[model samples]
Target chain A: MWSATDPRFGFWLPLALLCLATGFWLTDRKDSRKRLASVTLFASLALIVFFGANTRGGDTSETALLAVLLHMLGPVALMAIGSLIATFSGPTPVGPLPRGLRPLGFSMAIGGLIWIGLMLIEEPPDAIANGIGETIWGAWVEVFLSILILVATLAGAFCIMMGDERHKEAFTLTILTISAGLMFFEIMHNGSDGLEATGWYQIHWQQMVFLIGGLLGIILAFIAFIALVYMAERRAPDPDVVAPLTEEEKSVVDAVLRLNLELEEVEE
Target chain B: MSEKKDAWWGPIALLMLLIAFSMNLFVWQLSGGVEFSSIIDRMVTGFSLAFGITSFALLFVSLGAVHKHMRWQEQILGLFGCAYLGIKCYGWVGNGFDSISEDAVILLAGLTAMLAAVGLVFGLLLALVTGREHIPDLLLEMDSTDGDVAVELED
Candidate 1:
């Protein structure tokens, strides 16, 4: 039972509507699932954000089912989002999804609904963990996070390095290698701690790594900027150099054209 | 490199940003600020992450820029990916794996397996129901776009 007047709902309703509106505006007839996913996501966000993590509203027994479903909202919204990303990054949206993927998708979507059912069985108060199948299912977060880190660093490298020459990549690679080497200095390294370490709570090595990473990012931006400028400037050929062609060169060009046209006509 | 019809990812990311911002704004008045903030923040962080995820997904799967060939497979995979993250949320929260009872955990696994059978049943039913012609296209899409189709009839 959603309370339309739950003060918090006041804040969330409008925001959810905004998401719906934005999704509507951004999408068209073809990508209806995207719009549906977007709207569902926003609506789920409203439920999660406005109601807080406590899905029960006020009562414990009354909102139990709602709470369980609410728990599912975040997961569904996340799936919808992930779906959007998959759609975005994959082969240009086509007539149908790639062949092997459909089975996986069906299983996954059904799996999600199953997950929701499982969550409903004995809705745990905690946002995650403590559910019926906490171990296998719960570990999904860290798995994806680890994978995300790998993807980010690699894709970021490609996104920045694309269209550049081999030497440029070699240079960046060399710099990165050197950066890793510097970590051996111990002074340049931070005593490794998990994400639990606060910003100020971190040791000197962490700050060093942070500073170095930041510097490299800025440096990469500058390099990209320089490359763009050079590319723009180099778009035109040198003006002071060879004019059209010397008469002797012109004769060569005329002969080449004649031969090419003869070849074309013969081929035709 | 594959070219995109439009930078659709940009707007999607922007929308994620907006959602993230809105989440922050909503929790501006809270008691356990850190935990609540982190929960929403974790979800919002996916905005910047869209690039990496999309990049990775694109590496293996091929989805067109427009609504050209998007079908149930894509719909499920994306939906499944979302559903899959539910496990992740669980893994990260609380004492994580440490707090769980090993025996009880097995039950959870069985529960999922049993429920997966149920999911398959439901999926089959849905396929049958939505297979009807009167039903509109259910693929995630907007009302109108460049890809919209026009039909002609011959008398």
Candidate 2:
């Protein structure tokens, strides 16, 4: 009973085409299959754009699209590009990025962060239906505050433990910790536009639980994997003992060692 | 040396306990100075949802790995597993298919992916900055036993 004319078909069609394209692209190594994948990908994208433009309420679709691109994609893309440049433009360049570009990279990265901060404060897309902008800004604030608290706490603890030499650092960290903690309390009490204080508190606790659970799960999984590997290795029989190296093998080893030692000496 | 290390354990344990107790008290006070039941329920729900999402994502990834092996039976099973998990994710989000708008669902997925990407990028950037980009090589070096290295040198 499903037909192309169905209202939902527009959404489903592009998704199906995308999935098909991905499958072909991943599974096939041949050129023809790659061509087919490219074609399907383009077709899916074209369909998505066409349907997006022709939605029941065209203005809403356009607004949503603008909001997503501006609020979500733009900042992310800027951050990623900026971070990549900055990372590779260091004194020890990771790739082809010139060290001379470090300043530019830093500017871009900071610009991206400022954009995000401005978006949070301004709530430019808050008028969008479903309050997507508010939700995103709330999530960002929670994460930012969490990170600030965590970093400040850890740094404060470390500085305090480092004896008199780091007393100033410890004092600064304590101030930062207190400030972050206060900010967290303030946000939880006052809440944001579409969400109440109680709701914010609920979300904060939920996220804490989620974060703790995730960390524990990852740690446990890693421990389990390591234990399993150890057990499997233990079950394996020991390798047969090998005879001592022959004169030729010894000579070869000595030659390689000598070459390495000579190279080390030269480098020194 | 061992004794010195052991000497720190008592203090560390006491510190941890103190922190935990203080946190518990804080949470109790925050929960309207009421009984702990509501806070516990919230925590339980959060933990369950976290584990559920993690388990489903892991299952999907493992199934994708199976599919890559190109075994028909396993691939078919993986397809079914993926479909079931996809349905479960939808249910978790909206209770049913019709309850959530298509655009909202898409936005949620997109946001999740974007956040994950951001985390990944930052992590990689940290690694680069910390000169840990040769971690793969370090792991390979760790995996090579002394005897194996000797044998390789001889060969």
Report the Cα interface RMSD of each model, rounded to 1 decimal: 21.9, 7.7
Number of the predicted model whose DockQ against the real structure is largest? 2
Model 1, A1-268: lDDT tens digits are 6474352363334434544444454445566555554565567566645554444333322133233345545645444433333333334334445545534553454344344434433434543333322323322222222222222233334433443333433343334323322321211122112112122122112222222232333343334334434554455445576567889999999999999999999999
lDDT of 1 at A27: 47
Query: What overall lDDT, based on C-alpha atoms, would model 1 receive against the true structure?
Result: 0.36
- Models 1 onward score TM values of 0.24, 0.51
* lDDT digits (tens) for residues B74-108 of candidate 1: 34344335323433433453225342223222222
Instruction: State how far residue B43 of model 2 sits from its true place (Å).
Output: 8.4
The worst-scoring run of ten residues by lDDT in candidate 1 chain B lies at B47-56
Query: Residue A128 of model 2: what lDDT?
Result: 38
lDDT of 1 at B47: 21
lDDT values for all models: 0.36, 0.50
What fraction of native interface contacts does model 1 preserve? 0.00
Q: What 10-residue stretch in candidate 2 chain A is worst by lDDT?
A: A56-65
In terms of docking quality, model 1 is incorrect
